[model samples]
Target: MNFLNLEIYLDYIKDNGYRCTPQRSSILSYFIGQKNRFVTAKSVTDHLQNKMGNVSSDTVYRNLHLFKDIGIIDLTFQDGESLFHLKNEINTHEYKFICTECGNTTDLNLCPMEKMDTALNDYLIYDHKFEVYGVCPSCL
Candidate 1:
């Protein structure tokens, strides 16, 4: 995915009825800089502390949740920590192999939902997320 401008993100926030504060802009800028990589809330908080002085983890997490809720970002869990990345495409299903040790991710070509379609014929499926977690080769 291409790097998006800060104003695009800020405009999305405004369109979603949220204020585009400097702190939130900074957070979005950080994610935009990260491109497709995932980051933890603690890392975002730490980065904000350096950039904006003493940002709380709670605030970072709240904004993260807001961004996720508004479809601006994607979320996954590794071990017990939450990880986030800017959504590469809106409303598109993504499958990934996530490295638990390093948080690196690689796209997966297979979609398990395709194989399960027969079993789920009676139920309507709206959305799904598939992630395989393990240490990457570099971590090994």
Candidate 2:
């Protein structure tokens, strides 16, 4: 995530009345500060404890939930393990391409919602859920 983008997100959170504790700021800073491939609470806690000294995993988890609630990040999971990543950049639509064998996920450029929107108008479905699972090329 870009520094400017993160500053804007934190501003949005502050405008809505979240306290923005130092731990929260540091947690957000960790996510925004790095360019990482999906991450877990333990990974973040370990790095932070090195910097802040003696932080708890519970604190990390709490901030993770806060970030999710305010839309700064998105949650993904595999094999009963949770991973967090800065939210994918916005676009006309979003797609996740998942590989079962190797347990990898890649973002796709196509926007299914365009066609789906047209069909939904006729069918009048009020909501949608989009999750597409398939083997990525490497796994194939």
In candidate 1, how many Å is residue 134 off?
2.9
lDDT of 1: 0.83
lDDT per residue as tens, model 1, 1-140: 54367787788889989999888999988987875678989889999999999888889999999988887888987668788987665436778887777767788889999888998899988778898888889999
* Cα error of candidate 2 at position 51, Å: 1.3
TM-score of 2: 0.67
Which portions of model 2 show Cα errors greater than 4 Å?
1-4, 88-94, 97-107, 115-140
lDDT of 2 by residue, 36-58 (tens): 34577888899789889989999
Which candidate achieves the best lDDT against the true structure?
1
lDDT of each: 0.83, 0.67
Q: For each predicted model, how many residue pairs clash, with residues at least 3 apart or on different chains?
A: 0, 0
- What TM-score fits each model? 0.83, 0.67
- The residue pairs found clashing in candidate 1 are none
